[model samples]
Target: MDLSCFKAYDLRGRVPDQLNPTLAEKIGRAYVAITGAKKVIVGYDIRLSSPEITEALSSGLMAAGADVYDIGLCGTEQVYFATSHYGMDGGIMVTASHNPKDHNGMKMVGPESRPISSDNGLNDIRDRVLEPFANAPEQGRYETLEVMSAYVDHLLGYIDAGSLKPMTIVCNAGNGGAGLVIDELEQHLPFEFVKVHHQPDGHFPNGVPNPILPENRTATADAVIEHGAAMGIAWDGDYDRCFFFDENGRFIEGYYVVGLLADQFLRKTGGGKVIHDPRLTWNTLDLVKAAGGKAIESKTGHAFIKQRMRDEDAVYGGEMSAHHYFRDFAYCDSGMIPWLLIAERLCQSGQTLSSLIDARIEAYPASGEINRTINDPPKVIAAIEAKYSVGAKSVSFVDGLSVEFDNWRFNLRMSNTEPVVRLNVESRADKALMEAKTEELLQEMDRLNKN
Candidate 1:
């Protein structure tokens, strides 16, 4: 009822206070009213609070005269697949998606798995739920089905590994929903794999499986080195993003992976358009163009990226953060595609992961993306633009504030769910200039943060 639980992209908050069953029930009733769906599929993650919330949500849906199909414990993507595969009118997945354990959220999908962000339909749902708790409409029937295997078959359809050469690999599911997907894929894939922390432990005894953090990546990197494997792969809580470490235990930047995937997709589809986030994407754009494909740049975030992909009919898309989407997969981002393509490439070229991505890292040196907390994000963007936008070759305000010099560019965008502004700077293999410019921008941003 507080309504703050309705975030910019999804319904997420610090649990009970911001999100609870009372509100969850209201949300379910409101969702049915807004989407006008008679049947809705529901799925949830391994979070301790998920089961309780799912049941509460079901109660609300049934009260709203909608039948509920309980998909049971599953990852977010599985929910997406089920939503579309089952021909349900809509679906909801209870997850916070790599957020801290105490935090939980829900991601909803409509027919064709269309996302329901705040701007889309979440705002309306929020408004309806805030009005009052409504009476029960009907006792909707409930059904259960194990969807993991069906999801596996769906993912496998995107790529073939039967012709791939044997290579040792390491996978770390990071005590999240990743293991559920990886476990099924391992049995069918031909590669000799070494799995690290593949079990789904909600306690996250090994720490969250977020590869973006150095601490969370230790196990994956160690496994790659210890097993002397070709490479290692890691995923976030919902397994929607995948990151990698090369054979020597060196963590590869998400930018390079974007380039690798761009190249692979181009080869497979023969130069269709590709979408990428501007923060760490020039390399991907360059590769796409060289492969005779057009490149389209979207602002960060899966919601925006997928929208652009649908608009442009892009064959593939990637974010430096390791999210990959395929046209063949309904233009939705998947955490399961990257490693499969890597394995396919390794088999095709008989090359190690290092050899494949080495040239890309060297060709496009990056400063690695950084985030800065600021009191006034718009004021900071104004200050940076005032100081650096002069005489710049070009500037674009597509998602946030992006300024481009002849050889380097950076975008400063505020986080939708936090007070921090993310700064992503990239130069043409000029590490020194990138460092200097990064410091200058950070100093400017810090000056604004103080005011």
Candidate 2:
């Protein structure tokens, strides 16, 4: 097994090269041994290589004396749900999650569906997978199980199905695992879903299954405008993250969605702590405080966010990247719950999706996360820090370097999953100022690159 395949949070690498069935089997065996898990749940996404990987993983797990409950083709979160719901010892989801078709990986969770990140147990698994081990005397059993019905029930439990309005909503699954769940959800929802790229094609015939890229977002936005839909929803390949667009076909930044959802939860539950990432904070902080709730800042990334949420007993947590975590959902991030809650919020307020978030957008104009590829990320980060620190009122390193001034602030940090530095800037209710600062930062980044 290539140790490089193991990342800080999960196992992700190029297929057939960095990761393959052989390595996958070793990973399975290692996971079982490391966690000492006797019973585990395994699931795979709609990727061409997933079935083969799943088979190898199961073989290794069974060899390690683990009773494997194989939940056939599923989203990443389904494995998380099944692990906790079935009271299993652990779970693994075979998916690359919006990576190129040539890429594949795994996300593992221990009992209670808690993540097994590098700090917790991933590194141990990596070391064990490289070492030799003998199989158990008697092989454990493997069984196929269906989790969709229960999964759908769990999703429905997030909001009142009877309260949803009968309005057209655009759903662009990007030909990933989301279509199957959306199809199942339709039977239980009142809204009319205009499906786009709504098939589980492992080939990803419709561009890479990521909606965050501006080039990949046109289809969903156009569909919303063309159909006069109330909103548009899109998801990554594994359906672990969900993105939203307003009725006017405007793509809503996940930053505002954090505040919107936090406000909704706080209002309903009568006030609780809301956790937000450090990337963009003014909006979420202002909204949470206005709703009589406290806003806590957590580092970015699912494992970190979930851990912090559990620590604070936070009612809701959101990353500006569209990863929403709910305390009720075992503190795991879910792409399905955010939309359902937003739809329910729309139902209760009797307001259009666009109208609900318009005020927040105006109150805290932000430059949505802008990613830049540079040879020296650290040098640029240092340069940006030096340039801003002199006049900064406050600075933080909760997740990344966030420098705040009297009316504006920006966060610059390297991405854990990708080879780029992400920058987010926001000004207190001033779009022009936010734009100017964003440009200034970009220019600085470019100058450093030239040097």
- Best lDDT among the predictions, by candidate number: 2
How many clashes show up in model 1?
1
What's the TM-score of each model vs. the native?
0.95, 0.96
Cα shift from native, residue 302, model 2 (Å): 1.0
In order, candidate lDDTs are 0.84, 0.91
Candidate 1 residue lDDT tens string, 1-451: 4777788778788788988888888889899888888889999888888898999998888888889989887878888888888888999999888888877889998887888888889889888886765665466777787777878888887676576667788988888888777777878887787878888877878876677988887888888888899889888888878888989998999889988998988988888989998776678878998999999989888888888999999999898888898887667878888788888888888888898887776666777878887888888898888888899988788778888887788888888778989998888877788788889888888877887
Tell me each candidate's RMSD, in Å, in order.
1.8, 1.6
- Residue 87: error of model 2 in Å? 1.2
Collision count for each candidate, in order: 1, 0
**Model 1 regions lying over 4 Å from their true place:** 133-138, 447-451
Model 2 TM-score on a 0 to 1 scale: 0.96
lDDT of 2 by residue, 256-314 (tens): 99999998889878999998999999988988999999999988888988988889999
In model 2, how large is the Cα lDDT of residue 318?
92
